[model samples]
Target: MNFIPFLIICPLTFLAGLVDSIAGGGGLISLPAFLLAGLPPHNALATNKLSSSIGTTASTVRYCKHGYFDKRLTVPSILCALIGSTCGAHLVLLTSDTVVKKLMLVVLPVVAVCVLTDKKEATQVAAFSHRKRMLIVCISAFLIGIYDGFYGPGTGTFLLLALTRLAHMDVRTASGNVKLINLSSNVAALFTFLFSGQVLFAPGLAGAAFCLAGHYIGSGMVMKNGTKIVRPIIIIVLILLFIKVISGN
Candidate 1:
């Protein structure tokens, strides 16, 4: 409720948006900033989602304008992801949180190892037909969607890495598509949080403005620098998320 505490989050949200637009670990910054602002844990999460969703939408528009989207593959993937995430979220209600947390603690480390060791080979593939690429993207999107809905952290990084390795698509293009998927998931989470009455409107809006600026600038950098920069960023973010998840569990 204090203006000053919320104000501090604006600049930090900008930074979160910047890194998130590039490699998908924005929550690593924004959520903590919200909590430090004196919000309850659930409110911090809901408000963070609300703010980041706006910034991500901005990133999606920027990427779309730059010609990075493929509707054929992306549309199907989006649909699958929505279903998967919804199911995953529902399952979370029915399942044990401790069990899920332990599972992720184990799996995330292994995923990090795979990302570090296999990326070079993953990036080397030549090409794929539209149909094949669509199938892989859709299936992966659904699975990741479930993960996002059930427990979200590094969904974008995972999506980006999976697309790069499995689809063997252009990095810039894959980054673009990742934004779309992320935007959808964020919106889904945002609505759930919003209707639950957990979001703080003032701080959430302020953070959204800053996050928009950060994401706008970061999207430019990604287009210019290509995968050479983003790949490392993703790996680093994933590692950070892994550590954060393990520590929390």
Candidate 2:
């Protein structure tokens, strides 16, 4: 393995963390960087997960310390998301990426439009009772967890959108909670990749360190600026996902 690529992967991983920490689309950048560095698809994905899990852990801890994670929802969301992702991963073997990709291309634009237009609705919480809120969140987690597991280019963005629009979470709260859940999904995938001998630890560890730094900075930006920043980042990530899916890149 060439040692020179770390110079590139490290910075790119950090950038990915920054974007991902804010609104959830880090893999769109990091995975490409890994492949551009000449890692095979399997190695690139496995390594990317290691690096992202590091960044996400740091971000989630930051949010937890700041009192962003809702305990009532976090525990259930984690469990449901884990189980949902496992199911999605198993089902993926029987499904097709092209079909999913084409469908998302059509669906994402509509989601993006609704999210961009409704400033009030975006921040407003639903009128559900506490138990109902928990139920909705758990169900959303399972379904989106499955989606993340089956095809994950925009897992964070989708989670943010769902929670904000349906679960009545504010942008900042949604951003933070989604990070926690996304990390759960990443962990699920990483462990499998780890056992399969796919993760490239030397470079992945280096990327992880920088990714944590980026997550710190990005999460801070969201805290300070709130929806002003998170919304655009979410939109940008979605657009990037659209291109990525359509172009087959």
Candidate 3:
């Protein structure tokens, strides 16, 4: 609503985009930036979606250009994510925030330990057949999309983990597919928020520019550095998520 708020929000949003493009959990930073800048919770969430969806689209394109996307899994994953997000968004209106936040608190420590202990190379080949992998990816997309639409702190990060571990994808391909899945879920959630007239276009669009710049640069880093860059960021994001949940924010 004012220049002062953008001053605070834009830079953090850029950082959010950067971290998000590389490892997911951008919302852990960006949403709080909005809240810190004095937007109401609903407006912050809606506007953050607008800015992030734009930024994510840029990174998704970059990943596609780098030939990291898996063509066979894209359509089914996107479809399931869309449906799941729609359901989650609706479900949120009926649910209590306390319930979800408490659930995340329980889940975060185990996730942190797993990520910390994982020592496998990022280039490992999948053990699952194509059909099985597709099934795993789609189911994960749908479930994570529901989370994204409802609570939405670490959707991208969760998707990345699921892709890498459960689907047995290489990190680069999993990262690329995670972007596609996140973008779809973001758009689905954005439209729901838009319909409710909650988005703040001025700040959202302003934030989008910074988000785009950050995401573009971060995606390049991912393309060049791959796992070396991805793992640490995921760890940082998980820590941030832990803090956010513990604080009940």
What's the TM-score of each model vs. the native? 0.72, 0.73, 0.78
Please give the TM-score that candidate 2 achieves against the real structure: 0.73
lDDT of 3 by residue, 33-85 (tens): 77667675567767888888887787788789998989899999999999888
Residues 1-249 of candidate 1: C-alpha lDDT, one tens digit per residue: 876876668877887777666645666567656755666555665687788778777778878999897767778888887778766656554555456546655755554454444333236655699889998899888898887765565677788878888888777878888888877777776676566576789999999999888877986773653445545644554455456555662
Give the best candidate by lDDT.
3
Report residue 9 deviation for candidate 2 (angstroms): 1.3
As a TM-score, model 1 comes out at 0.72
Q: Highest TM-score: which candidate? A: 3
Clashing pairs in 1: none
Model 3 Cα shift for residue 134 (angstroms)? 1.6
Models ranked on lDDT? 3, 1, 2
| CA lDDT for candidate 2 | 0.70
Which of the two, 1 or 3, has more lDDT? 3
Clashes by residue pair, model 2: 125-168
